[model samples]
Target: MDYKYLLLVLSLSVILILSTAQHENIPYEDVPDICAKCVCLTAHDTDKRYHHLLSCTSKKFQHILARWPEEFGKKHDNVDIVATFSGNNIELLQQLPATNATLTFSCRHCGIKYLQAPTFMDVPFIRRLDLSWNEIASDELTPDVFRGPYRVTHYESIALVDLDLSHNQLHALDRKIFEHTANLTKLNLSYNEFRVLNAPTISALSSATELQELDLSHTAIKSLSAAIFKSLVNLRILNLSGNDLTSVPDKLQLIGRSLVSLNLAQNPIARFTEESFIGLKSLQRLNISYMPVLKTIGKSVFTRLETLKRLDCSHNPKLVEFDLESLTHSSNLTNFDISYCALTTISLFVNVTQESHTDIATLAKPWPHLHTFQSIGNPWYCDCDLIQTMEYIGTEGDTKINQARCDTPYFLAGALVSNLSSQYICNLKIPKQYKAILEEPPRFLRKRYIILTVIVAAVVISVGVMLGFAIAAIRRRLKRDDFGVEPIRYTSVRSSNLSAFSQGNTNSIIVNGNGVANASA
Candidate 1:
């Protein structure tokens, strides 16, 4: 009976163990909280709007999302998940369902205050946030609200990779804002009022080991110091165009030497020296266009770029000439835009590259392997010298010199600006040298004195004609008996002429009809 009772107790213990295991292993399919933030629900609720953003299969935008702190909502009672309400709509932001909101963004019209301290939602694993065009001040981000920068999100765990805070009213850099974003790569603070980038700002960005691209375009940057970009080792592109930089900063060679594209357009660059791009060995595209004050380009400006391809220095007013003889070895350049510069003729770019997008040769002559040439707005003198260039383009049929319209020389201003076609506004004058020869004949000058001497001898004959005319007039007056009217004016002029003759030809006198000397005559 004892053995039988023990076996019944063992069976009861096995039954209890099996029941506990079943309860513990029950699936979470019935829980409403687990189903709340599922991908399917989030995707469906957002009307499939954020399908690409919510996608985790790829790491394309991983660098931009790592700016926000990891453990968000650690300090506040009401947690927030959705990042959309931070600035755009305060009423809607207050109504946010609030928990695990990873990303947030708003346009320029958002009225969010810049001084709002960091909330619990900012501490979580949230990665990306775009407050572009919002007039947010520089003091809003605090580490206490987000539990510091090193925190992480347990779900979909990954560091943020991208951040775009462009077009904001940020007047200055508060380095603490970026101190927490240690893992970010691409950062865009473009179109801001950032007048200066101090040492703290550089240090904060250098913490992000994966930074690759940084854009500070359209800012109030007066200068770019070497200390600002020293930490970003893997940087590929740095855009600082549309700023007030008068000179290209020194020691930019520290940007990993692998930088590809750099835009320095619309700056106050007066000259473009070859040393301006000394360190960038792997650079490809460079845009320094639209600088009106830029006057000269160093002959060796692009001598070092072996892999450099496209170069655009167009829309510069004072740039008169571009001689590409020194850059003949860099033949890989494909697209070149030197349009609207001070190029008077098409000879400026004879053979700069092997393959180009503009056909500059068509404007003057069929260039050797020339492509798209945007030579316009120069004082293109339409004359016979351009006919050779036109002939080459007409035969090759690939040169697009038709767009290189002449802008100066009043007659050809609006005309179809082809060098070969238009007859240069018809100058009808003879050659100046030939006209001078005709005016100053050697033989005529030699006989000039003789002709004057003969004219003086002919004056003796004129005296005889004047004497006869006077005698006839006197005879007419006697016939008509009209001597009362005095021919004072005629007599005075005749007397004056005779007086001059008497002064030179002395011993000569004028006699009246009765051989009486008329002293007045």
Candidate 2:
């Protein structure tokens, strides 16, 4: 009788153990507002939920959905428990409350390109998305793949905002596929194997009219045409870093009202010509950093960026110089970096944080609001050439330098010239390095000798020449005056005794005739 009672007690205990295995359904009232119909066992009040399960945040859930999951009505009444996708488990997506999806993921071993099919709509709550890392690559797209927002079966309005398809092995994307995501705000297509993008692809994005931020970094886009970004008029932030862009065409007329930030860092854009930044009037920050081969800055290359605030060009080793004079007039520039370029000194007619010329004593007018300036790895010649600029910079504030040495002029290298001497500038370290240009003690003896020699030589030569010429002229004039008169010669002689002869002719004709004959003879 005791054995029978023991057997009945063991059966009752087994029945109670089976009853414990059943799940106690928590009422809907106990769930957070975000998880009323959702099966999240742990959702805080801060959890977000949309009429269409907008996103699952704050809680980790393993979702499980059948390939042919039943849909009850406009609101999905049936969604399974979230589960992990493992090898032994049947391949399945969790759930979708929408009718379409743009599949983008990468799973190399499984040979899955992307699972962007309407079959995912049978899962629950997903409309648009980013499948960045799962291996998924498909070339041909059936018409069923492009049936997300176009189908009016689900809602009066679609709930698609952003899509990211980076890190996938996608080689071909039909440009027409973007029309289905008209409501998307941001699209990330970076880190893929796209050598060339057809023009119609960007144009289709323009037709979308809502894409704000587009990241096309790490593409092999070799060059840029005029209308490459023509369709993206409303794009506010564009990231084109890590590409092969050598230059930007002039036809890139990006309007000011829409664009604010442009990041083109790490491209092989060796040239920053005047027309490089043509029509971007309202740009605030421009990052062209880490470009390995960018060698130089063109004159007025950044002229059109009137509203620019920050310009970063820090890591281009071949960039040897800059034009500081042209940018001295710019009032909007505040933060400027040109570190690691082969800079020798800070002269005028380039983009700079200050009017960075050397050897000037004081500022005619200081840049009262300029913030930072970077000039390192340059050949700094600390002669009379850089005294004034060095002094002015030291007076204004400390200019930070790193691993830079002045390389020239037989002396004064690695010796800090920023504050060595105002009057004299010599070997910047030895004997306190004082040897001035204009305001040192004069060598009176040597200067006097030189001055006297020049003055005496000039006066003596000039006086000697003048005196020689004057003496010669005076001698010639005196000789002409003294011997100017000429002597004249004349002939003399005669007598007339005709009257006396005539009067005595009567008395003494014979004697008068004889006397007249003698006189005549």
Candidate 3:
């Protein structure tokens, strides 16, 4: 009876364990439709949903569509897909099988030589697309390269928001390339061979009216048409650095309403006039560094930028004067860099932080918002005037001023201004007496020297007379001893004392009581 009960209990435990295992395997059965779903990896989200990610990067995929899996898209209609085909050997990208899904596709570094309308026929929605580092040419591509047969309107044809086509050999671009893609917000076409951006190019780019961030750097672009960027009214960050621009492009005024950051570094701009930045009232950050030929900048060029925060004007060795007064209107300035500009004095730069320099009532403290001043690599004159400025630096705790080195006044060369001594400053200035003498004539100097000599001689004669009287008084006191000196004043000695004076000498003196003196021979 005991063995029978034990067997029954063991069977019941085995059945319970099998039931739990069956329930755990039910989720996989519900997930179907795996057609052409070549997911490289799958990740679980916080809500326990699986995200399918596919990448053919560096796989040397040739004609990816030809190798499409047979079981792709079996049951599922909508899915999340992230696809990458970078660093592949795919030359031509033709029509892809249609799918209604959110997608992010990257084809950078793919040796694609041709792209047709059906290239993305299967892909209707693309949030981000990267086609950089390819061999696509401007003339070979049509404006409707991404247009699908079913997409009738501009919004239905192009759903791409971010596109990158950098590092290509494109010399000119067609306006129709972006005509169907009016919703693009960010575009990067940097590192191309575009020599000039004329009216046609500007008109072509105007189709994307909602563009916010654009990068055109290192493109060898020489000039831009006036008001070329007028259509991109929503642009905020524009990068034109590393170009051949000779001046601030006049077309920038079109986007001045919303531009926040402008990079103009690595150009050959010779001067900055007031009209150069006339319409950049909303600009906050400006980079004009590394300009080899930049020498002159107008005093009021930055007056319009009332909300300016950071200004980088470094690495321009020919720049001499940067009028701080012109920036009085820029009350929101925080970070300023003027390093390596060959400045002769820190007076102009340092004094701008004081209350006397600006009329802004909000600036109660010295550079209240300024955190860093990269003013190093400049030839600072460390005279008495600069010493006062250094003291202010040591006392102020908020401002981080560094690399404040001296380049002139041989004694203070290579020395930091914060460590200078008071004695050294005093030694550098001329003495008051010498300075006064230098101002006087030679005839006045001679008269002054004669008067000084006469005063010194009179003082010496007075001292000599007082010394003679003191010596005579001392000698008279010695003569008035207790001995009788009436008989002879020669030596206070009597006749009996004559032997003590003579002894064995033949010539001797003798004195009697009658006060007469005789010599014995």
Ranking by lDDT: 3, 1, 2
lDDT of 2 by residue, 63-129 (tens): 3222212222233233222322222121223223333322222111222343434323232233345
List the global CA lDDT of all models. Answer: 0.56, 0.54, 0.70
Across residues 1-521, which tens digit of lDDT does each residue of candidate 1 receive? 98987887777679547744643443322223322222121322343332112211122211112222223323332233343323223211111122344443332335444432233233444466555655666555333223222222211222355777787666666555554555677888898887887776665556555778889999888987676677777888889899999887776788737688888999998987878777777888889899879887777777777667777888898886554544454566655677778765443333323233134443443234445444556655554333333433333444455366654444455554554332322232223222112245566466887798789889989999999999998899787965567565545656755776778854455567997554542
**Residue 213 of model 3: what lDDT?**
92
Q: Model 3: per-residue lDDT, tens digit, 364-408?
A: 533357776777888877775466444533324555557678876
After TM-score superposition, what is the CA distance of residue 409 in candidate 3 from its true location, in Å? 1.7
Stretches of candidate 3 exceeding 4 Å from the true structure: 1-39, 44-50, 65-79, 149-155, 346-363, 384-398, 420-521
Error of 1 at 403 (Å): 1.0
In model 1, which regions exceed 4 Å deviation?
1-104, 115-127, 143-158, 346-372, 382-402, 407-521
Among all windows of 10 consecutive residues in model 2, the one with the lowest summed lDDT is: 22-31
Off by over 4 Å in 2: 1-112, 119-128, 138-157, 349-370, 382-410, 415-521
Q: What is residue 44's positional error in candidate 2, in angstroms?
A: 6.1
Ranking 2 against 3 by lDDT, winner: 3
lDDT of 2 at 249: 41
